[model samples]
Target: MPNPAHATGTDLLVLHALRCVGFAGLARVSEAVGLPEPDVESELIDLAVAGLVTRVPGDFGGWGLTEAGRAADAERIRDELDTAGVRTAVTRAYEDFLVLNPELLDLCTAWQMRSVDGVIAPNDHTDPGYDSRVLERFADFHRRADAVCAELSAALLRFQRYRDRLADALARARSGALDYVVDDMGSYHTVWFQLHEDLLATLGIPRH
Candidate 1:
């Protein structure tokens, strides 16, 4: 499939991802864009050559946007929002997204780790009852997330991809792909993270 991030002919998606996530590995970038690692690496190289982004070499380091890249992304994303005439709508949707953000994080945490004996511990999936409860909450969370995605798609068509991706993640989780809940690259938390980035970028809102 063609890259949805580049369908609009702008690198704002990748640039803003770096802006929000700080620095990240190529695997993360590829997961976020639903593209292969090589494709994301190619784009990262081009951005680096243009002095808009930089690659950090270290065990814990990866790619990050330059100051210039951040500025460019802000300008371009703002312009795109204005051009689409969806600033007001997207802003409103973002407010709604914020309300759901904490709960979503809670779900992710519950999925990856469980509260046991008043201490947060990794969920080893030993207790069927606990797993079922978490899965139930996840299903409920998806219902609310659907509304946010709907509002976003209404504002900008490109935002529709998030709805599909998020649903796919949840579906995988339900189908016993436990990693899809959080740990895996295409997990529910990952898709939600990208949607959060998309909302901030579309509204030209800074992540402080």
Candidate 2:
């Protein structure tokens, strides 16, 4: 029998992507769902027409789920999990993710700030040595994280997108676009944070 989770339509994919990622523009939404910009925009319009989603217009604006959309997503995702029979697998991965989550936050903090004389100060990127040290640590953390991501993807293919996006962020960071590590809007930290939200939402778990 075909897995019901794999039967999710594009509407659910895009809608839940917005739910996980929060407010984001076209490109980010497209990147999250592994869809093209034009396709995501079309689905957003459809979702907007149904009142489950809304679009904000401005330099700092993007798409977000409405209250109704949140409720709908909760119900649908639960159905997806139970119908697909992968809840246990997802739950186990979520536990592994919890172990890695704090380390990721620490890395992001190290990238953007630093400890000096017991005071937390913003990192101004003035010291190449300090920056390189943090970057190396992030790479090491990612290697450890890859295992959890792989486990999730093995159960539900949609999760593979997270792995791909995370890798892209690291690649850009390695190529000297250091902002991709944590500063850019869709940086590795940002994407990992969103994935955290996604895993919790999908598992019906509360965020701490």
Candidate 3:
């Protein structure tokens, strides 16, 4: 049977993407959902019409979910999981993700900070050897993380995008885009953080 949850869910994808990523501009939303800017804009406009999202115009403003949007997302996502009967699978994957979560946090901390001259300091990327070791650890952690992501994608196709994104971030960081490690908006840490939020939202779990 076709999963009703995955099929015809572009609107849900846009809504839930905003839910996970918080307020973001069109470019970020497009990137998050792997949709073209025009298409995402169309969806946003329609969602705005429905009073599910609103846009703020300013130097720092972006699109965000309305209160009704949040409620709708919660209800729909719960229905999606229950309809597809994938709660157990997703919950198991989430548990696996938790196992690897601390390690990734440590790796991110290692990337952003280092011991220098017997003092802890922000990583300045001046030491290629130290940076290389940290990158190597990130690569190792990604290998394990990929397995968990695979399980999620298998359970819900929407999750495949995260696996692809995390890989892209790691590949870019390894290829000398240093900011991709944790600094840029689309950095590995940022995307990982979004995924964490997504899992919690999809499972209807509170952040606390």
Candidate 4:
């Protein structure tokens, strides 16, 4: 059996990152894979040479997977899960994630909007008390989320990045960096969404 902590290198990491994150620049790709830009760029170049990915030009341009890349990612990821004998473990983790998914969505909504004068209004972060309450709930939520992430990372090491990124975002938000909660690119909600995408992609499940 293959090792559970598979070091697939940038080969599958970069390709599968694009598969899950969609079209993204070098920086976003690097962030997704927890690797340096130069390393990701080199992998992207090699993938492009193999006709698995392509870099688009102009504004809003970025690296995206080709149809071949998508097919390849699906095949390889399935093989990896089966070879590692962790498909059932990962599937259980994914099910646990689904249970937590709704609570997370509710938390994001609470962070972005609040009831004011009996009317729903966008959160302005001007109310310290309200913000503190939300942060408290987030801290509570993170404790449960961390458990699920631990289970996932045990089955597949690459999933550890999500655990790390999610914790970092929450830590920053607790430290008063409000944007880390939902606004920034590496925000808690953003990483959660990517993890959702990654799970779907790995399981070969179509997004609804």
Full-model lDDT for every candidate: 0.79, 0.89, 0.93, 0.91
lDDT of 2 by residue, 17-128 (tens): 9999888899989989988999999999999999999988999999999999999999998998888788999999999999999999998888889998999999999999
- Sorted by TM-score, highest first, which candidate order results? 3, 4, 2, 1
Question: How much lDDT does candidate 1 score?
Answer: 0.79
RMSD of candidates 1 onward, in order: 4.3, 2.4, 2.0, 1.8
Candidate with better lDDT, 2 vs 3? 3
Candidate 4 worst ten-residue window by lDDT: 1-10
Give per-candidate clash totals.
0, 0, 0, 0
The lDDT of model 4 is 0.91
Off by over 4 Å in 3: 1-8
Candidates' TM-scores? 0.79, 0.91, 0.95, 0.95
lDDT of 4 by residue, 41-159 (tens): 99999999999999999889999999999999999998988887888888899999999999999999999999888999999988999999999999999999999998889888899
Judged by lDDT, which candidate is best?
3
Candidate 1: residue 120 lDDT (0-100):
85
Query: Which 10-residue window in model 3 sums to the lowest lDDT?
Result: 1-10
Roughly what TM-score does model 4 have, to 2 decimal places? Answer: 0.95
Shift in Å, residue 165, candidate 4: 0.6
Best by TM-score: 3
Cα-based lDDT at residue 43, candidate 4: 93
Query: Could you tell me the TM-score of candidate 3?
Result: 0.95
